[model samples]
Target: MTIGKGLLFSLLISLVVQGCHSVVFKQSFDKQKWNDKEDWDYPQRNNVVDDLVKNHRLKGLNYKQLINLLGIPQGQSEDSAGIYYQIVMDFGNDIDPVYTKNLLIGFNKDSIVNSITINEWKKP
Candidate 1:
């Protein structure tokens, strides 16, 4: 065989091997991440919020009760009268698009929740 032909053949083999290696590595890495308990595990903290929404009911729940249940608001906002607690949750897949649910629990002078608004809620 000619040296040039051998070199070209060797280059093609190397490319093919490298491509196969890349695919294998990607699959294994993704598999490891998927199998990992920490990655797949739902946040225990979120269950408390879930329980509130599922069991306790959102609209009737008071401000102090929510604070006690969910630990604390990630952040807070205030208007002319009183403050509001932000209940933010993430729900989406890896590619194409990501989504979230943001609930605003507003309070009046007595600290009872005056309104519960599902702001930017995407889930059905």
Candidate 2:
């Protein structure tokens, strides 16, 4: 083969190999478990948030109970009448798109959970 032909063939082979490697890596990644709070280094943080959301019981919990169950919030705020706790999760494939979920819990004056809100979105 001519030198130019050989060089072109080699470049094509390299690109194909690299593309295949990326596909394999992405396929092996477990998106469901990525950055899962349950797997975080902090032992206190678990999947309690998932459980609470799944069971629809956040309103039944008090401030202390909620803290004990899910540890501290990523963000917190207080007002004259109530307090808010926010938990945020960002997880998805590392490729083109990603997803995020946020949980906002509101407590009444008595420190009992009064409302729970969840927001989710996708990013590219």
User: Across residues 21-85, which tens digit of lDDT does each residue of candidate 1 receive?
Assistant: 63422121121232233443323323233444445554555767756644455456545443443
Alpha-carbon runs more than 4 Å astray in model 2: 1-50, 77-99, 121-124
Q: What ranges in model 1 sit over 4 Å off?
A: 1-51, 57-62, 78-99, 121-124
The best candidate by lDDT is 2
State the lDDT of candidate 2 residue by residue for 1-124, as single tens digits. Answer: 6999999999999999989864412222121322334543322112344545665466868888877655566666444343433333344547533654556677787888887766566785
RMSD of every prediction: 13.3, 9.9
The true-versus-predicted C-alpha distance at residue 105 of model 2, in Å, is: 0.5
Q: Scored by CA lDDT, what does every candidate get? A: 0.49, 0.55
TM per candidate comes to 0.38, 0.43
Best TM-score goes to which candidate?
2
Per-residue error for 89 in candidate 1, Å, reads 6.4
